[model samples]
Target chain A: MSNIALRKIFAMLVEKLARLEIFLEDKKETYDRPNLKFVISCEESLKEIKQDLLTIYPVLAKTFEGKVVSAEETQKALEVYKKCLDKFLELHSLSSHLPLNPIASETYIFLSDVLKIKKTFKEFDSRIVLLTQDFLTRNTHQCYTNLPFVSDIEKKPMALYLPIIENSNPLYWPILVKNIFGNIDSLKASAKKHYEELIGQKASLGQEKRKILEKIALQLTYDIYSMKLLGPAYYYLFVEAGVFRSIAETRIRYQPTLAAREQILFSELERQNFAAIAESTHKWFITLSELSDEMHSTLGFKVDFSDVQPAMDEIVARLTREAESVIPEKYLFKCSDFCVSLAGFERLKKGILVASSTIEELNKSKKQCKEALCEVNFTEKTEKLQELPNTPQQIINAGWIYSEYVYDDLLREVLKSPQLDYTPFIKHIKNNDTLLLNSVEKSRIFEILMKKEG
Target chain B: MLLNKKHIMERLVHADPDKKIFITPFINPEEQVGSVSIDLRLGTDFEIVKGFDSSSKPDFNVSAEKLEQMAVKKKVTVSADPAEPFYIQPGAFVIGYSIEHLKLPSDLLAKIAGRNSWGKIGLFVNSTAGLITPDFSGTLTFGLKNMSPEALPLYPGVRIAQIYFHQTRNSGSVKTEDAGAGTCEVISGNIEC
Candidate 1:
């Protein structure tokens, strides 16, 4: 048998399998027990296809045996062989449509062996599909059908389908079928649960009204930033807070009836709900703090009250000073004595004065200080500077100055160096890190640098 | 348009003998004629060089010489070899430079086409090759990508792609710069240049 003969046979087998697939798809609805019948027909067709394919295998072997050719001819032969192999594998895949049995396993092993040959073209898709089917079948018996509190689990197609889909390789048709079945089951369960909850409590509510409330609840629960439960509590707090202030402002006019008063009292009960939500927020914050602490410990940073306390104090003082400056004159007059009684007025004034200076002047001073510190090295000046409390505001100010320095100095150098390729660096920075830059600020800096270089 | 093997060989030989055109039937050329196109193969040598800055001049002669040396030695140790050369697997499409220095006549244009065999393996010659000017010189640089899932290893001197030449209406007496004849003209006024 010649290679040409084998290829013809392979093409014929593929055509036959394609026809069978179409027939199965069309007849699926007519058969009451389609699975059993489908399996039987598929098995018979697969056996015939396999026998036909095996006969062609000898023909392909004969054509390729001890053939010497020019480089160009070898290349063409490889391509032809690959095409034939792909068609052969496609025909072989009909076995998978049958029951998960010894035949399927044997077919997979035979295909894997055929793939190891130095053929130019191998059919990857057919192998991927067969592997996926085998994986699903192996895990199907382990699938759970009796989940707790979920009545009629067998009726829910998802319970039957999920294990197959999740366990199977994603490439297979069965996995796609399983996924669709599972999604339908999940949607049905969710809709049923929603209906039951809404119907029992809000019998007077229309479907649209219930739907709106449900949507609001879902939105609150799923917000990534606010962790799950805080959403509902925040919603209630917002509603109650607005009503509470309104009621406080307009008392009897708003409270028309005794029933309205009772309603207000019941809504007030949601204050406890708000507190629980706040507690959750606090817990989240605590978790964040713990993670930071672990990071610091791992990085071998010293943990002391003195190391962090002064920074906290300076931040509080800066915030207080800003608040005082923003207050209206009339409001200040009312609280003048209270403000005067507070400590650190002189320190606040000094900070305000330093912060008010032009960036150039401040930068000059900072540079001078840094130079002096470096020169003094082990001197008392360095120790004194270190002893000074570093506030969040000061840290933030330093960060802003550092970024400006980099933009003006380093980035300008980059722009001037035409031979330097900054693309990879830019790509890395853009993909991997978030720079603390406002769009306007970044654009302004970039524009200035580009103009100077251009 | 439906020229047989004999005519194709004659036309190609007469077309540009100095241009080193080789035709592989069924191999999709950069541009397909009636039924066949010549496949372009990867040249033995490639140079990955640092691009010039705004102030720097692009000297192709220097780069080409360096590429030749690298190819001869089979090793490059100077200032990070610019061109990284790799073999295109049997069914794979790898980027390579053309061996021929194609200089299209003023009234002629050329388009690169992938071979049919390559196209069958899902190897598509990208639309990088464009109108070859009348007085262009130097090898055409090709950027190849394999659309197939499997690796297609390509070798040097294999017909990997082809160029389809077309004759344009004669527009007489145009300056070289205006006609965009040379490498300098292509790079000039371009952003990267």
Candidate 2:
């Protein structure tokens, strides 16, 4: 393969590497996970690959005037790129969820993130194949450039130059005289060797073949060929080489920048992780709601607030721990806020329990108060009646003074006589006990009857 | 055979979209779907059998109207909405419903039983009527009896029972007939009461 062909392939590989790196950068910026070690590993490899592409750019561009560059080194660089791509694919496949096609099952909505990442990988793989084909077949049909010479003082051509090798400094001829004067035969032999090395053919005396060999020798910076300066041929080669050199240098410089543009992490896995955490969080909330109901139901009003305190504490602690474990650190604050609200729910539940106890106590106290009030009313009425006079005669006098309705008209008549004769009324009193009487009246009547009998 | 988790998941995945076999107001599938059964939760509404005059015999044999009069329907809220819970006071019996409404396919016949965890605490959960009929779509009502020495307080949304599904021989044809029959629309017709 020609040096230009190798350079073209190298450029294509660099483009793929840069794209992969960009994808990683985007992934790192957004969806990077602390849990999946492979993601971080793939990212690290991408960074190294980017550096490798930058280092190899100038090396692959260094096809001199006549000498051909071997495809061996470029193939090795391509291998590195391919390996990186393989790593990316492996990471993607390992992380992707089971494909839904074979199962013919409707996936849970939460699995959308996984499907997205799988799509990314699928697209990445297809692009890689297309790029690889472009890399392998590019610059194969045409001779892209003739090598340019380094010019110096007096506007004279000074020495032949080659672009920088990947891991080495740039190469150029300091003097063209030594090869012309000594070992000119050996220099031709060396040019013939390079022709065979690049084109896989022996050099011949035919004009076209000789011209190609001379050009190859000049590109290799063979001292004899540089010294000779064969008239129109050298000038034609130099002019041709100048156009290619300008184009190659410009291309090499621009290539890295293009690759740099696409460099950043693009990770769907992180989005998937976020979706998973959200799904789990949703489920946790539902379970917690159910558990809260059960706890409230089981111990509810019957158990004191203190009885449920530990259980509430346990649930809160468990939820926090679970959130911490599953939820990314970036989302911890939101989860904590939710947990704090859950604690608030427990506090509200506690208030309800305490209120239930308070109401029960209030009801019991109300019942006792009602019974005590009934007893107090009975005692007050009794004490008021006991305030009557001790002597039966005085009691009778008080009753006659305060009397509104007479027990009978006969009793009223007896009382009207100021209790002078009660004998007649006593027999009537014995017969008619149904007549109403105050305590004072009854005492007085009994005393009057006793006196009369005596 | 009693359906296991694998079979259950398969059915869930492939079940008809319109006639999806499901539990509504869905909780966690991991927690609800057990090896043999699905755990069901207690609902808010309850019908408590108030102590009646056992000494005097009534002339009318107990009718629907009498049953309605005999039982007190109470809805219990767990939070501060109500101060008192529906307490199944020691030696008391109450009826409660499941929070989730179930839709079973014709191929399955399910048996509802009280969870052992609650049963150990002397809470017996049973249906007054026997096994759940296929093609049934309603919240199951359970007769809850607290045989414990202490008053057992039941708040809404607790796991009181589990329904284990068993494969029935005449499931497909029976389900089609039942769904098309539309006899279940009658409130009294569907309810076991």
lDDT of 2 at A279: 31
A82-124 in candidate 1: lDDT tens per residue? 3433343343344333222221211222222222221111223
Question: Any runs in candidate 1 off by more than 4 Å, and if so which?
Answer: A1-454, B1-36, B46-94, B175-193
Best by TM-score: 2
User: Measured against the native two-chain assembly using Cα atoms, what DockQ does each of the candidate structures obtain, in the order listed?
Assistant: 0.01, 0.01
lDDT of 2: 0.37
| Candidate 2 local lDDT, A1-454, one digit each (tens) | 4443343333333333433443444455655465346457665665665555554444443542335544565455445534543443344344321111111011111122222222112212322222222221121111122222122212212222112211111001111121121233454455455444543433333544344333433333321122122211121223222322222333322111111111100011122132221332232223222322222333231112232223323332332243244333432223222222222222122111100111122233233334332221211221111111123111112222111112223332432343223343444322221111212222222222223334
Q: Kindly list the per-residue Cα lDDT of model 2 for residues B1-193, writing each as its tens digit.
A: 6677777655544436333354543333556778877788765456766555455554367795675565445543232012234578877788887755565665655668999998999999986546665566656789998899999877545678888766555512333333233222222223321
Prediction 2 TM-score vs. true? 0.26
List residue ranges in candidate 2 displaced over 4 A.
Answer: A1-454, B51-86, B171-193
Q: Lowest lDDT 10-mer window, candidate 2 chain A?
A: A258-267
